[model samples]
Target: MGRHSPAPAPSAAASAAAAAAASSASTPPPRGGRAPRDADADSPSAAELRGLLEDGDGGAAPGGGRELSYLQAVNFAGGLLLPLRLPSAHAIHKRPSAAYLEAGTLLGEEAGRLLKLAGPLFIEGITNIGAQLVATTTVSRLGAGPLALSALVLAQTQLNFGYSIVCGIAAAMETCAGQAFGARHYALLGLILQCAMALCLLFAVPTAALWASGAMAPLLVRLGQLPDVAAAAGSLLQLMWPVLPLLVVSETTGQYLLAQGVAAPASVAGLTSLACAVPAYWWLVGRLGWLRGAPAAQVSLQAIAAVVVVAWRSARDARVARTEPHRATWRGWSFEALRGLPTYARYAVPAAAMLCAEWWIWEAVVFLAGLLPSRAEVQLGALGFVMQVSIATWTLSYSIGTGAATRIANALGAGHASNARRIFVLACCLLAVANSAVAATLWCLRHRLSAALTPDPEIGAEVRRILPAAILGVVGDGQVAVLGGLLRAAGRQSTGALIHFCTYWLFGLPAGVLLGFVFEWGALGLWMGVASATALQAVALHAWVALGLDWQREVRRSAATVGALLGSTGATPTPAAAPARSFAIAGLEEDGLTEEEEDGDEEGGGGGAGAGAGSALTSPAGAGGGSGLTSPLLGGRG
Candidate 1:
């Protein structure tokens, strides 16, 4: 209600839609000697009869808007339902085995880093802000019935946090699928999909169970300990289930595109959903006045039309992608797809948990805020705005992080350590420069920004007080962002996940609450927690990057844990472990072979993972690769 991060700027689909309109022939040629009647075609005869119907409506009533041409119509339709179209198109265009893993690896690495640091922090801000908005708007507009709104916000917050994990899993799927495509392991892609499906199915149960176990209102009341809050949360949670499948589909589709270097649809989906959902929310609850119980029902019913159009188009596209079904290799549900399940699940589950941990950190902060005075409500709202602003900008970090992850993984898998190092340097430089700019802007705007959110001077004051610390968190947030993406990309997701859990949950949230409420620092204290946690995570993420992830351990754990699941589900058994090859951080130890031998081996059957690690004292490639090293390298102090 009060606003958060300007709803992330109209998304790729919206932009495309607008572009199609502007570029295409705005008007249609005469049809029936006047205009084409396309919008209400019942059938072929019915279509012909449409002329009669139009005539019945008094002289062909000039077809409201010009009918779009085939291309224009397709583009327009795509924009209208871009989320389903773009993602589905990607899956169709690149079958699992046909994708490029190196590219995916690069993207995944970057994505992992961005996700680890910035991603979670970004969402925390979003959910916190969302809670604040619901609180503030409800108080502003419907003081008497604000409790229902609060409940809705709490429920929404939980669902919102939960949805981020769905996004992560989707990314994991996209990354692996992309990699398998590159490696020409077509079956691997199927395996990844199979495992992802199994994992998604597996995850849905636990997450749903957790939602149910929370007892909805009681959980909210206990966390916030507010009676009105509890009631609102319960009602909201009850309605949340219907949205789960939608969330999963949306996230998976978006991630699939990211793997293919397509950002528009995912971005568009986010923008469209926020823009559409927010207003739709007002219409269902505020205008229609369905406050007594289950706002989700009203929401689900309203969304049906949009869903139908999108789904119908998606189904059609999927069908079109496969002209003829492959012979049933093994009957009912191809067990062969199960081959990659263990591998994907191994990476995905922790990746999902890592994502969940990051989200929970902010959720904890909001929980802490609930314990404070109602004035804290305004503070939380203000925090949300700051966070959204940060995240919208953070998208750039996600792009870079995804790139790094893909590059690092690809180089490593292909045995190119130097390239991986160079890529890492590039990511840090880009992220740092971008973060600095955001910080400067925040500093300049802090004063004027707070007053805009509310009429109350007290709320404004609290926001300004917390603004500096919050901005500091934003900077640290960027570092963590790339680091997390890099880790996931490099197959070091567990390390990143551990760092997140420790920093946010173990340290940050608690510290913020204690300082804010216990010490009477108020909103500023809450932000202090954010700064502290982010700083801690930034240090750890960088450290892990400097000292590479224990891939051996990761691979082993992934294999062991995922193996059983895959076996039970009829997926392939684990492949034999390769001989461990170790190198210093710079990827130095060569396997000693002639150039011809190297080339031959590279193309031969004796394939292996990425280059050995070591710091290369080699000159930077065009100097872009080493743009941000401030201190002296090789152990010298600046």
Candidate 2:
């Protein structure tokens, strides 16, 4: 699509004339100009005015309403698009020259909204990593030796691999459910949730089987791990075997709630699970001194979180049914969910690939650390500590990103293109500030953090030595986390997967191998390479968001995606009795019409509520409908 500059600001004289024209149109025209009744008849009705605004067309309305004068149409369109543009001098002066104050107020409001959404998610993420951190710390306190730490790291790596797969699969729900909820397709949200859970369970079975099998030990041994370390890791894997399916349940259900902006249950569940597991870890690992206690505690943690989240969801569903039935998203399980599986997988597979591609690279880095010719145990332990710190930081960024994704997807689903872009920009700013603070704090306490995480002086020293690379990685990770969310919101997971493969596997790993093995820089070199790759990935992803994203196109696609899912299941929205496109556009505020006003207009026009509002904007016959206009601010056709 060709780009168009923003519409020029109207002159004072033009504004006056437009206002006068509008006033004249409302009242009777001059006696010699036209008959009062004829002028009234010639003027567009409320429905036609709505059509003209929504269609972004400057000509006559679709149903042959009288042609609007250029000044009148421009003024009308300007008023509709005004909220999207920066405040103009004249517009601001009309409100007592409070432009700067208003802008600051708006910025504060948007920031507060984002933080409120991200706060619970951040707490949940911290609690998620708490189990691993506590286990690692417990092992260190018991003086379990580098062998134990190495083994724990390897086992956790495998578990993370499986978890990432399930997470990627579940990520599709963030888009589908978020959009469905925003579109007010409450029943569709339930079906999407079920479909995602089913897919995650289907994938979890083999992953759990792999962890349960004896093959992991030999595989690790072949990958250059020492015999004892490989065996120990395999044992831990067996103890943690049940976490995969439990994770499927937890992750899917958590996504379901998050999509609907219900995060308190997950946060509470995470805190409760962590609270219960810490003492279990203390008693089993620190007190009784069982090496196996760590993985066992992890198993308990996952189980508790899964049970709590599921129970909370059920209770929430029941309460909603009792009080607000229309708001409830849970419809009991049915074959409709089964029918949506293929549709879910279309986004799920690529999402899985995107996560796994990046996730496995860290596992590869750990394996490479094991291959060091000297002090392999110390290197492995150090790398494990660093990985834990990195994961903790990543969870924070990921939480913020997930929150942003929910907001962005909701905006797009509701045809609020300007709102989605605004959210993206706000999220980026928030992440940058957050990541910078985290990096500064981490840098300041690197030595202390290293010493506290590991009892061994050698491992601690190595961790301290390589700490800067991990800090750099955290900065890059913050960027990619939110950018990845943007991709997911736009349903571009396939593109994300490709970017991950190219950046990490094709470039990062090879560079790390060369730097560590060939150049003899060891673990630090490997981390440096990975950190550089992360930076590159962030750059590429950011470029895409800035240059390639088309918010209006995303809005259209969201409608189509939700519509297709509904069609596939032979279900229609109950609250939204209008056509699907009308329902999608119902949330848009660009037409300067309140819901009641639009409803009245539609009803008066002999159409269902919202029909007049959406039909003229989304229908092919409307100007700038299926074939979009060449406006830079508004994206092109789908």
Candidate 3:
């Protein structure tokens, strides 16, 4: 009744008019005191305006959070599990950690699948010639200098350092290139490609030269290793040194090809080296009897072949590099490109150290295993075979993880935080499902697999007994690979390096040694220790990425550091953007481009306005407006 009586006045419009007039009177007008249009009147204040920009700007997408499609699930499962079955057969025996070999299974499988599904069209379009060499065959077979052989084997030990450096550098390119590319910066990609090539040449060529000079031997000696092995290693290093130019060219060009979604070059270079090197090694050393001392001779010939193959490959690569499009939009080199040198240096140096540390630790294990009683050492060697098998599995994980890296890196570069979060989640789910299958398969094949690898019944039995733990260790380690990749994708190498250091040095190694040597737990202890460290590392890396730490600042910081290093090489730098905020990926494309390219686009985009970074080259998604998911993760350290 009271409301009805009050409503009798019906003064709603008048009341509103009066309130509006009063509110307007309370606030001062513009300088000219003219009435404003609705757009201006509705325009938010500075704080509100900031929020509006933040909300509307497309740094993160809302609709495309990752959800598993049947194809993705199948793809993930096949990638994760098949490598468990075939890794050792591929590249397990030669690598440092085998994590990439294991994780790379996904990449191999994907490559195969793409070729199969899309046929020659896919193969021609997506092949990576450079990667083929690394992934398909052993580089040690490429050359024939006794000194080169030593260098190459020793070089294998240095691969981790090289991969980390490559990944970091490529990522910088991806960031810078992605933006320029998206904004139609063709000229930038071209310039960046040249600058990057020069940078790679500067370091890689010199490194190969020093490696060949037998100078690397003293370094090993400094590390407190035996003189005999070091001497041998040094000899091998010298023989392999001549292939340095090839290696440098392969890596740098591979990155360029992968970044541009033209991975056939990487695969081709890889295939050429592998095809020529492997057969050359066996034919020259094993059949032809080129030199004396089986291992040394074998190494020498391998180096010679590697050099020839690599040299030829490099020449071809040079032609390709020269032919790349030179767009007119290519702008002048910015101060940012030079400025980013320090940022990359800061990130890369620690990463390299961590890589070296991890490699040395494993080398110590292999060496120590050699020193054990003959029977124990023999058993350890058998265990080594098992480790190889496990590593092959890890490559699959690495490939998948790198896929994750590509997605995350691409999303960030594209300023799509939500998409990055989605990619992260999808990767995690795929890893778990894949790892679980790996555990099951390893469990089932323990008896047969062990028997096949060795003739001794006792050794086989022992291997069988520890098989479960080993597989478990692999699963855990594979997960860590993905997480580490995630960190790299986010341009958080320092965090990843720190996690790797703590896990491998403080946790994995010490614990394994204590268990294997002190407690005499043997293979089980070693496997358990590895498992423990992997678990810890996975957790730590995931936490860092999952927490969505300040990525833009990381971008800025990394840029500054990388810029500083390149500046010394005569590269210019660009101005820094406002620091990025914390971000997470929710959903991602199951098939983003190769990990390096994905990151390369973004890295290249933001680092400097390089010609390659912004060129109107084909995107990862191909020519279709498909999210261009073809960028490489730049985290293919495996």
Ranking by TM-score: 2, 1, 3
- Write down the worst ten-residue block by lDDT for model 1: 620-629
Model 2 scores a TM of 0.76
CA-lDDT, candidates in order: 0.47, 0.68, 0.46
TM-score of each: 0.59, 0.76, 0.58
Over 4 Å off in model 2, which ranges? 1-96, 139-150, 213-215, 218-224, 284-295, 447-461, 574-638
Instruction: Report the lDDT of model 3 for residue 180.
Output: 35
What order do candidates take by lDDT, descending?
2, 1, 3
Tens digit per residue, CA lDDT, model 1, 538-615: 887777655644332222222222223333345332122222222110111222212221221121011112211211
lDDT of 3 by residue, 1-638 (tens): 00111112212332333355457546776895443321101222345223322322232222111111111222233323222111222231222224334545544443332222122212222222222233223333444544434444454565445544544455444434333333233444445555555555666677777766768778888977566557766665565454444444444444443333333443343344445554555554455432222334334433543354345435544554466433232344454444345434444455455445545666656655554544675557567767666766766666556545544444444333333444455566666787789878888888888988788877777778667877877767667766765665555656666777788888987898788777877766666776788788777766765454544333222232222333333432232222222111111111223222322322112111111121122322112112222332122121
> Which candidate should be chosen as best, given TM-score against the real structure?
2
Tens digit per residue, CA lDDT, model 2, 1-638: 11222333443333443465567657755675523321111333445444433433333232221112221232233222212223322332222124334445545655665566677788888887776678877777773698888788778777887888999999998778877665556677788988998999898988788878867999999977789999989988877889998988888998887776666767888899889976888877865454578877788888999999999789877887788676578988888787888878888999999889988898789878989877887887788789879888998898888878876776565555655676777788788888999999999998889879889889889999899899977878988888889888877888889999999988899999888889988898888888888899999888876666656667667666666567666555544323222100111113222333222211101001111112112221112222132222221121
Candidate 1 local Cα displacement, residue 604, angstroms? 33
lDDT of residue 428 for candidate 1 = 77
**Residue-pair clashes per candidate:** 49, 0, 161
